[model samples]
Target: MALSLCCAWISILLLLLPSLSHGGKLLVVPMVGSHWLSMQEVVEKLSERGHEVVVLVPEVSWQMETTQAYKVVTHPVSQTLEELDNSFQEYVAVHLTQKPFPLNALAMYNTSVHVFNSFFGQCKDLFRSQETLRFLNQSGFDALLTDPAFMCGTILAHHLSLPFVFFMRGFPCNLHFAAPQCSSPLSYVPRLFSFNSDHMTFFQRVENTLISLLELDYCNGFYGEALKLSSEVLQRDVSLMDLVNSAAIWILRFDFVFEYVRPVMPNMVFVGGINCAKKKPLPKEIAPSLLNCGHAISLHNVCELEGWDFSFLFQISLMLFDRLMESPLNLINKAKNNILNKNIRIKLYLRHSITSGPRRVGAGLRFKRQILAGSTI
Candidate 1:
């Protein structure tokens, strides 16, 4: 069956990954909430394939409405040298560069308020110090694939010369747009000013100009502060914008169901659906949503999907599970059915309903190991 073929490929990919690990540490940083759920899907498969994966994430992520199964390292977010560099334009003005300094300095201070500000200011000094360089060099990570939200991570990646992969949690931000068009406007950015006079309607043009001001101010702040040491130490002007542009990767974490997906680039992939498999199985109320998704959630398709192909399958199935779990009445009846399992044996196959075939095999393997190790027959 197709399920059997998929299983074989998944096993092949997983087996291949350990060889790639090369006896080195595998560190993964997953984003919060549904993002974490996506990471969990991959982690479970990887772990099952015999690779050890340590999840590093913000401490507060677990407390949110995640899938409630994955265990991740909960660390406080840190401000990295790259971020300090973002606002470094101020430092750059006072110290280095001789290109229209005063006007740029004024712009830098104005853009500081509209950013993804956080409590990381406390560790700013440490991260920019030599201590950070030493820490990165000694972390012993062979490979790192993390979210772009953390500047410290990317900077650490750069300092250590370790290969790093970045996973973008939302739509990729273009050169001019900080926030998505439908989402909350980045408050610090004034407006985008990239458009010419005939480009758009008045309101859109105004918004664009405002976004542009924010970006310019952001650039001014960045070139001034973050790279100030460059002219003095390394003899150059490094900007935050430049550093961000250089991040190794940006993996989008959304379903193709969303509107207006951008064209795929070499560094950016449409892995929009990478976390939907039942490597386990649907919860009590998820069957209907699977029904709603029409034909995507098939045991045959799922069992047979292997390697990178499963990423798309997981995305669709995960979305359906999310949609189904939203119904209260369905949840209550699922509970009732479980309680009435004795009377339902003649019809619905309740015991096998929630079971995933591959996981059952995993479970069987574990049991066989235990029995083989037993002292008694």
Candidate 2:
């Protein structure tokens, strides 16, 4: 009896040992705005799983808030919140108004440069602070989690000599695939901003190859300041690709549904639809109206609707519908007028059939009546 009790106690201790030793301290360096939203979910989950998470943010930031899930450590920065907001607004304005191909691309590139410059200014301040550096050095973090949309986290992870993982949709110029040594054939794998599909024609393939050649130069110019800053911080010559290649793992925020068929590296893990894990209920004011509407159209890009010339879309809808409404033109006019006046920017959903149920038209309206009527919002 005594031997059996001792053996049982030993077995219990062995089982508990693994759980006790599993948790580790993690340092998270996240990007601002929408990027942070998805990354925040990851931080919270890590905390819940018994790991200690420390989120590093700038003194003046857009939406990097303090929370119970992780400890927040803010560093001093040169730029203010107002400057960041203005730069983003300017970018949006240029993106919305510009239409010509190369001209629009040029305008966007210029605005993005200004925005990244502002972010780099803050990064410079982070490295300048001896106090912040000292704290990080003493923290004894096991690993780092960061969004590689910007270089601050990548540089910092290297400075700290910590094993880091990247959590992002992807990097521009197909650097994500290139850094991982993943196979990306130009024949089918389209270059960024090339606007070519996976299945390309003979001429399109030539265009893709040309763009692929330009990508290296484009990335170098785009991240020129970051590369310089990285060299200064690390006291070594480091290219952006070198920094990207150093990541121990890549937590991609997409799955096969969103991405085309391609070769992925062993280190890459896909966790698509992570953003939709937590869904908020519809607003009380709009829920009932949305549920009652039968046929709704969800417009994702409001900028595309700015011109209010939907004659082509109306024609398509007419073909989809079996029978036209009493006044098709009037319905279109009312939708345009309502959208202009109300400035509705929410996602709208459309039912499968026009004859099946009630028809209402407006912007910023969402419907789940057909597909998701039984599910909780």
Candidate 3:
């Protein structure tokens, strides 16, 4: 009878063991705007996988909506949403309107400094909230996830002495590679904004080298205020590299198909197509149009094409399409006439991924091949 009772107790303990342990607790500090959108995907997935997720957001923000997937903690910020929006708009306006290289570069630098200053001000306000800081310190979070572009999360993670992961498309001045000690040779690896392909000419390589050299100064200027604020918060001398170098992992939103080949570290993970993981059925209004169209072209409005005439390009595209069609000459003529007479419906599908130059060109070529093979867009 004693042996049987002991066996029964052991079986009960085994059954309850699984339920006794719980998923890890994660704290996420995401940046504003589109950056938050990408990070939110990961946050929700972690929650679904049984981990406890807590997201920190400013009281006033753009696109940081409350969701059931994770617990959101709002902290007081000094800057208002209107002020943030206006600064961002000013930066975008400068980027889009200024075309001359030297003029545009100077304008971009000035506007970016203004924007960074405003963001740093918000970071300072977060640190001032003792209640929020106390809560975070006592939360007993297993790890931290954040976007380093904003710098606030990284600073907080360091302050709390938590191992953190970085989620981003890329960092300004190649900080992503540099902070992680990843190899990035300038000979073929292009610097950001250099617009150089992997196959570089002699002169292009030289330009790439020069740009790489200038990146240090640019980064310092861009993050000067941020570095100072970080030191003040930590109560010690600190640099951007110090804050980022100790990251446990980096989740980069990059794919080889769209990005040039480059060396990466083991801790750096490339989840390029993570944004496309969630699939939804096409809307009723857009689905039929895609199926019925003979050919479709998507134009993303990244910035204003000041002098380019899109209508003429549309006509040219249609003409090329007509030539590429392997149909009877009579059928081809009839189709061309019908398309022209029907005014050639042009639909613009603006997606975040299409913003990159290589991806945009690759998508256009893929669409062209699809159309030639008698497939709908």
Best candidate according to lDDT? 2
RMSD to native for every prediction? Answer: 19.5, 10.0, 10.0
Predictions in order: lDDT: 0.43, 0.74, 0.73
Please give, for residues 1-377, the per-residue lDDT of candidate 3 as tens digits: 99999999999988878665589999999988878877888899899999999999889888787789999999998888778877776766565453565566677788998998987788888899999999999999999999988788899998999999999887778888898887788897988667778899999899899889988789888888878888888899987789888999999987755566667789999888785565444446445654455644333441344343444445444443333332222221111111222212333222234343311111121112112222111
Give the TM-score of each candidate. Answer: 0.43, 0.76, 0.73
lDDT of 2: 0.74
Error of 1 at 112 (Å): 11
Ranking by lDDT: 2, 3, 1
Give me the candidate number with maximum TM-score. 2
Error of 2 at 175 (Å): 0.8
Higher-ranked by TM-score: 2 or 3: 2
> What digit string (tens of lDDT, one per residue) describes model 1 on residues 1-377?
99999999999988878454334465665544345556566666665665555565443333233333333444444555445444433333332322353344444334433232332232234344564346445667676666544344444455455676766554213431232222323332223223233335666656665655565455444334334433333345655554455555566665433423234446655466484443454555655555566422223333233333323333444454454343221211122111111111111121222322221110000011222222111
- The runs of at least 3 residues in candidate 2 whose Cα sits more than 4 Å from the true structure, single-residue gaps closed, are 1-19, 292-377
